[model samples]
Target chain A: MNPAAPRPAEPSASAQAVTELLERSRALTTPALRAAVGRLAPPMDTVAAYHFGWIDADGRPTEADSGKAVRPALALLSAEAAGAAAEVGVPGAVAVELVHNFSLLHDDLMDGDEQRRHRDTVWKVHGPAQAILVGDALFALAGELILAAGDDATAARAARRLAAASRQLIDGQAQDIAFEHRERVSVDECLTMEGNKTGALLACAASIGAVLGGADERLADALDTYGRHLGLAFQAVDDLLGIWGDPRSTGKLTWSDLRQRKKSLPVVAAMAADGPAAGRLTALLTADAKKSREEFEDFDEAEFAARAALIEEAGGRQWTADEARRQYDTAVGALAGVELPAATRERLTALADFVVVRSK
Target chain B: MNPAAPRPAEPSASAQAVTELLERSRALTTPALRAAVGRLAPPMDTVAAYHFGWIDADGRPTEADSGKAVRPALALLSAEAAGAAAEVGVPGAVAVELVHNFSLLHDDLMDGDEQRRHRDTVWKVHGPAQAILVGDALFALAGELILAAGDDATAARAARRLAAASRQLIDGQAQDIAFEHRERVSVDECLTMEGNKTGALLACAASIGAVLGGADERLADALDTYGRHLGLAFQAVDDLLGIWGDPRSTGKLTWSDLRQRKKSLPVVAAMAADGPAAGRLTALLTADAKKSREEFEDFDEAEFAARAALIEEAGGRQWTADEARRQYDTAVGALAGVELPAATRERLTALADFVVVRSK
Candidate 1:
């Protein structure tokens, strides 16, 4: 939401205030979600609780490490930026978070990645059975959370957009999974998949914020574009770091993408090349049935270097970063179109940058 | 659902008319669900289309081995029984099916089941990620379909019940998974879990039927009971055949339940028994690790025998069958409570018996 004119307080209070506002956002969501969840089909509480990270195996609370709550921030910030009342944004907070969590619950299962945010993926820990239910539960809750926003036709419109975006998100994830098994992946196809996978929810987040701001479809569409850019930038940076960043800092195995022969932009371009580097990469990737860790590690190093070289030669890496900047510019352009409160717009811009700049 | 009043009719006409009516049900649901699936949700159409057995991997019309249309049957039957206008029950038919399919999508994932109705389960083929997205897609459609019952209020209420039931179904599935690892799984717990897992949706099917009929809460409650009893009876019969029935006929691996150490009623009772029988049963169940085919075969024979012996001794199998009978009685009692045509009541009774008496 737009920051109000300075309340004669030092700037030092901003971070603490932001954290507390986030905490309040979460607190507001819990009861609202709980009430909505209660109305869901029976036995749904378990899935709901698990998705929220409230209960472990025995259904007891140990610790909570939910995601970064990025979507909610986008939503509330956009709403406030547009000068919507704070109360109006509070409930939408739940809608955005629910949608975000729902995606996570489903995406983890589809991606087949075993670890997320340093925790055993829900499916791995609780089995796919519960994970599926958990995802379904969140899906149901997310719909109700938005619908229960009741009278605000804008909110309802926002809910419809959220649903539409969810469909795109699902489709994007499918392309990503398909990319893993496909023989060749073009940059265009990868961009399309990444947009759907990452951009859809972020767009919904910002769009919902605009709706809360009483912005018309015109404003909402622009905000959607803004979020889409943020999402694109987010993925591009993540891909870059996946190969070059400190492994410990990134919290992922070093050269793990190359070792796994992931179809990331660099690897795909490198593999498409018809040179010794490509041949070596292909030989390592398509070798005999079995592969040992030592062999994989050595191959991973060579492939990583080759792919980096290919990225430079083809300008693929720069191209990705440039696209991110285009998205960023588009996002900023959209902000200019809206007559939002300056301070709130500034916060949203910062949040947009934060999306692409996260270390882990 | 109740049947229409009996009347003399030519055999050819009756058979022809019945086929038309059955096809009519398919006609109502197909479009509602299909329209809800957008190009954005790629694998949703794939997974859902697969569940219906409508398309092969490449997405083409095949022989539709869609589920037996059980939920729709109840809706239409209830509507006909109540003599409600077609407009009322028609949308309910679509709603119930959507809810049923939505549950099936998640249930398959939660159970870690690899196949369903002779096809690869959603998670197995599409992977958990797409399976989850598909399930969510189905859920959104279910709500949307329910809300199609004319006007926001009626649709909202109907959708609310469905949302509630979806939660319970998920919760029940979670309890089922949790029971798998627990040391002591009481008979009551299994029964309760089964109720949530199976009965909740069945109850919802009938309740939706009543709602379509414009039946009051009492009538809806009666349908709910009928659905609950029928669900339990259905599970009891399934458990019975899991051990004693011919695998060729049932199309399941013979005595697969025992091999899996499933805590069916007889097994639970046997485990709860005194002395040697209980000890032997405990020894078999506490070993959840994989078993040799021979060991499994031995356990199969022993489990079948032990269950029969316990059913004979503790009267558990007889008790289970009796419970089935009790549920059937309650269903009939529920039917009695509803003010439908005499012929309709008889048909519902016949259907109830058919549900209980079936071996497969």
Candidate 2:
């Protein structure tokens, strides 16, 4: 049973529930996001608009795949969980979306990725300098939107949470970049890096609305823990898809992470495993690294398939799937520690399920 | 006399007065700035420390030439002008400095500049990815610092001001990059870019302290106007130094802007002049542009010197000097519109005077 295979047309109740939540989030959040981005000056504004899928390269309007809007959904739901109307969380939602996209724009440039969401990246479309500038603009706009969202104190608290998470996100990117050059990386170190790269912002998104709504630290921390675990689960699933998911669904080539030589969870876990398979896998990767010293892109598909098989034979695939399930359970368990409404808890739980099972 | 020539050891009264204020501002602001940067995780903290001259690249302590701290002085003094103690403005000062340095780090990479303040730039020493990430960390730190500084309302207001200025600064950079590709840039266009690139942040620095101190918009606006004019004056003088100043004093090569084909104030002003020399300059620049299309750095010293002479003969240098003095007068005049303690008013005036006439 390949997890990446297409499912039946009839969606499960949990999946249906999350689809509505995400749609609602996009409906409420995109306008605020548009308004904030509209405040930017030309060229930077144009680059950002193109980046956000509001316009095409020639400046014509087009509704493209912006993203899943999962972070915004979490923010809005977090507000509802705190007993405030979802409207109260709009600013937080917009700010988180902006930060997420800002990171995406810069990351695409730094990672040398030419495409995102089936379209050319900002850097590829409008030179690298514009990519850097537009990203900076969006980051500034995020801070501005949060700061102006409410009374001075509430806004400051919300902004502080967002800022801390953004710093962690950047630090994570630095660590990920550093990891690519090292020959050995522990599973723990890889998890820590992923926690910073993916978990920090998700945790902030899950609780920033509560912060804005003046929720107590204990409740917010519980939500934060839930989001963090969910992010790790999300990443674990993503790692699995990187090697095995269908290109039609994932919008990536087969063995994408392996090709990029990313020290993702499965790769690290596989390397850490004991057995002749793991040793053979390590030796193969070492030889590949040496052979691809000048051009990593020249590796053949058969070689990648062999590496994937080796990772699976060494139990990396099973370990990652188990880890994803464990993390999802822990994430759902976190909501139980806080006295959230049953409906809110169910919705959050459904969102986590959607994250783990997402094919794209 | 050459305006860039070193001055005598004996300083004038106004210069002496402003020097003491800057020293005092740095003394108060550095500890807070250091503390804010210290909050960053390792690698980022290390890169930022090296950039700030707090530490050498090898991780040893070294008090290198950190910048003049002019923006922080303006912030601290703005607080005092609003009837608050200078300490009340420390956060604002630190935030502005952080934003300023953040731009510098990104700008150095975007501009491909290897040196700043006589040392290798962050990108040069640590590579482009770290430069980008560390700059982002600093920018996030700036927002966090401002938001945590005071009551929610005050902090939010201050953060909004910083955010607006930051966006404008980014827009200016975008425009500057665009100008490099354009064949003609008007003097007015150059001035607007300079204002956005240089004036917006200066304006924010001059007013953020007052915003933090709970001053009304009237006083803040007045200070903003003052700083805007002062910044233009500073840029005009900087344009002069870029072309004619002693490299030893300015820490740049002679004809630096010319070598880069920067359409700075003097070049724009000269091209706009209705004279044979201006026409000849334009033609020469056009030919040079075509010749150096493949390699911009290949222009000889004789060509740059000739371009500089043509600009001066066409009245670019004289016009820029007059413009700098005019802006300085206007900046000083803005202080008179707002009622402030006489000492505070005098200090601002002295600072403006120093900016217009400084050799470096």
- Residue B280 of model 2 has an lDDT of 99
lDDT of 2 by residue, A1-360 (tens): 234222244348878999999999999998888888888887777889999999999999999988889999999999988988888889999999889988998899888899898899999999888888899999988888888777777887888889888988988898888887788889999898889999999999999898887788898899999989889988998999998888888989989989888778888899999999899999988776665545777778998999999999998888888888888888888888788878988889888878877888
User: What does candidate 1's lDDT look like per residue over A184-271, in tens digits?
Assistant: 7877787788888788888888778667667778878888888887877777766766666577777787765665666675555555
Local accuracy of candidate 1 as per-residue lDDT tens digits, B54-108: 7865677788567556566566666666567434666676766766777777777
Candidate DockQ values, in order, are 0.28, 0.69
The top-ranked prediction according to TM-score is 2
Question: Candidate 1, residue B177: CA error in Å?
Answer: 2.2
Per residue, candidate 2 scores C-alpha lDDT tens digits across B1-360 of 234222244348888999999999999999999998888877788999999998888989998988777899999999988899988999999999999999999999999889999999999899888888889989988988888887878887888889889988998998999898888999999999999999999999999998877789899999999999889988999999999988888889989898888999999999999989999999988776675545767667887899999999999999998888788777878888788978888888778867877888
Q: In angstroms, what RMSD does candidate 2 have relative to the true structure?
A: 3.1
For model 1, report DockQ.
0.28
